[model samples]
Target chain A: MSAPGGVLVIAQAEGGALSELSREMLALARRLADETGGMVEAVLLGENLGDSAGDLIAFGADRIHIGDGAAYTAYLAEAWMPKLIEVAADAPPAVILIGHDTMGADLAPRLAIRLGTTVATACVEAEFVAGRLHATRSCYGGAARETLSFKTGPCVLTIKSKSQAALDRNNGRKGEIVPLAADAVQTRVRIVERNVSAAAGVRLETAAVVVAGGRGLNGPEGFKVARELADLLGGALGASRVACDLEWCPASIQIGLSGRTVAPELYLALGISGASQHMAGCGGAKTIVAINNDPTAQIFKSSRFGIVGDCQEILPPLIDALRVLRDAKDS
Target chain B: MHIAVCVKQIQDPEMPTALLRVDADTNKMMLTSSVSPVISPFDEQAVEAALRIRDALGEARITVLTLGAEPARQVLKAALSLGADEGVLLSDPAFQDPDSYTTALALSAAIGKLGDVDLVLTGRQAADFDAGVVGCGIAELLDIPAITFARDISVDGGTIRVQRVIENGHEIVEVASPALVTISHEIGAPRKASLRETMRAARKPIAVWSVEDLALEAAQTGALGARRVLEALYIPSRDIECEFQQGASAREMAQNLARRLYQANIL
Candidate 1:
């Protein structure tokens, strides 16, 4: 086998387009590749993701490898692992980056196991120093950050979403796209059903402004205020793990280290006490605004701006004010 | 039907943030050493998910499994109190420092040793490691169809229907028996055990298995089998003091905050 040198990203696709996390991982890969003096490549697996290769290259991929198959349509750890391992063997990259999403979470550890490495997931930052790669990931439920390094080359990482900026697309630049087929795929799982949720407004993962509510909102009924505020601002609604645990919101909207990571321009946390676990997910936001009744809540430390008050009393007026602002901007 | 539910005992996540300490030099997390360990909240939910399935199916045997030190017996006992039929604990000094992969390898071996499992259930991820890997890893190792992020599951004869939470929406999937499923928080909390059941749980024998008993190769089961190395662990230092808006009333604070957000260009 050839000595690994370049960085390869597993560009996972959702809804025909590459997932936002895949693009973000590409950005990180580009930075790492540039720092380490290696090429940034991507491996995409799907039946009809052939056109998405352009997007990958535009983001910084020097080469794109597509392993297209009908069996590869849905995310099954059993199907993608064999193909990804073969891809790495065929062109051994020094670093293999996979997004820490649902599919990535399932696929990365198993792939790392197959390749004789342990995977570091939910990594917020990574750097290559003197040819050694270091990753900083949150552990202990986001209360602490753990920096990891491989004893050998070919470190596999499951990157957190929204960790880096995607490079501006340049149609002028192009890279190599290689089509490879898995010699064999032993798949046991089948996606008997597939559904794409119709989000009322902006998607939570990519929203520029996020309005998240926590247990202090009291119950599922509390989300009505949050949803109204989100709609008025054209933002997205998110929930704390507590709210999700309490069945106040969908687990899909959980905003924490264990859930989705968002780097929105502005994050308005309503009634959240700002647990380290929750802050780990929203730490990347340009400006975090936290609202809680407790004056000494831990979340206030992570927030750039905080309002100490009852969300029940404050939210309605806040929504009214936002409506006035939106109405003014529209006019 | 026979089901295997994997659970773990973890440092209490609900401890006040001030009580948690990080040691970067040793890469260690100190949780005051006073917070009693409890069943990983998610895995506890998984135990409940299995019991719920048993409740629906009727006459199903549930085996609670854990791969950790002797203290992990508590997680098994917790599962038993919730009505699981039996318990299994995999413990050995060599099993120390097993990454998610090695952990999955050892757990899969135990499950295989148990034999005739109609379904395997575990939390979406352990709260301690929070890697969310072992369940799917076990499925891959066993070559069984695995469903994750399951909100709910219902069984009919030998078929299983699961409602899975996807990225944005929910999808209901149907599968044949002998499949693996990782229960998410959406499964609802496990049933609370009565004092009577808790007493009976104390007497429930937990079968302990060692790495040698499971016959797992050293190259495949513990620190020797791990792939990644931890270099450092630390609490990230804060940067900027949080500016709190002062107002006599909640409505006044809302108004001040709204104007301030506009001035800060965060609106």
Candidate 2:
């Protein structure tokens, strides 16, 4: 099979095209296309995604393949994988990139299976060399890095969350929006209900500010301070897996190798000791601040700034100060 | 009830770092030959869930299947010692490095060869790659219902009740039998194999099958059958500066740290 002359950016529209990660992927795809002399095709799979194509075009997509349907909305793997396969087959792209979310992790491997190619997940970077695609990814609990390459076509790679900077829009560029037929994929595993986390306030991936709790929170009640800070900042609340496993917070709020990865503008680590597994998930954040009573905590090693104090006493005053600062700015 | 749990032999991720080799070319870590291979952590949970279902149903049979090199027998023995009634090892050079889709198809073939099975269980994701797709892929191939990331499983009547762990929370789902489930660590810790049971497992017979015996298509069972291609792999550099504070007076040091905390706007 001949390699396609374009790159396909698979967009998981959980947060719509305005999502920072989608914009980042679009920017990365644009760079890859410019280097390889290929067009950047953004494939948006979601219900009611026709309205989002213009937004994608502004971000540098040369073509858009919209797989819009009810089934595409909630990310049913059996339904979405086949659609991706069909899109790749119809207009085979040299490479296919996806966001490293739950849907991407599930779909990439299945798509690789159907296409007989290599698929790398949670990739932090990629490039083309000698007609081969090379990607850098963290494996083995983030202990090491490995550069993998494909010997075949339609290489599938999922970019880790918050690793790339969002691309600035082109303002007036427009792309061709091609509606692709949704392949018939019969799945017995139906998603009957999707209950979003109401307590977490905002989705971790898209949040601009994130307030994370850790073992120092002591217990569930200790998380209230972190939650208050998140609410005050209009950010998302996150926790270490230990906190989640201990039932101090919902698993969705956990930020680690087994939990969600966030790349917020400001990440507040409260009582987090910063284990490697936990650090791997948050390395993409622009700036990190650590507050822990233990001055020797490992989190200070990763934070741009560090504070040695009890989060309990420190968080309340910090929240008050933020409130005053914001009120002053608004006034 | 007849349940089949697919397991894999994996390097112990928690092993001490001094015993592993880093692949110079790919920068991937290679387990030292001296390190022992164990059943994947998640797969052990799957086996435990299968045993629970068997105990609940009064009369049930459990079969464990693994597809890998011949050395995978060690893992099969471990599974048998953990109460699996029978074991099947699908060994062939073609089975090596087959991506998730091919592995699923090959495992499904092995299951079909086992005759009638009511439930199939596997780990949510392998520890090595952490790609949680096999159970769902097998479900797609068999056209059966599948619940991924299941923390709890039960059999009631002709249906299976499972608690699925999602991002923020969990859902209690009830599906009909002949379903597939991928168990997670949250399900329950796997029971240890007693010395007596381990010795007994050594005497137990393990059935071996080849790719030809399962009748899997050559095109459907290798890297050529993979749909996704890896573009590249590279290790990320860590910028960590370990800072240590040494002092004798606890109160004095605490006050000094407090001043530093205030300066950093943490207090």
Instruction: Locate the minimum summed-lDDT window of 10 residues in model 1 chain A.
Output: A182-191
Docking class of 1: medium
Q: CAPRI band of model 2?
A: acceptable
State the RMSD for candidate 1: 2.9
- Return the TM-scores of chain A for each candidate in numbered order: 0.93, 0.89
Q: What would the TM-scores of all predictions be?
A: 0.91, 0.83
RMSD of 2: 4.4
Report the C-alpha lDDT of model 2 over B170-206, residue by residue, as the tens digit: 7666677898888977775688998887878877778
Q: Going through the candidates in order, what is chain B's TM-score? A: 0.94, 0.90
lDDT of 1: 0.82
Model 2's number of clashes is 31
Backbone atom clashes (below 3 Å) for every candidate: 4, 31
Distance (Å) between predicted and true CA of A258, model 1?
3.9
Best by DockQ: 1
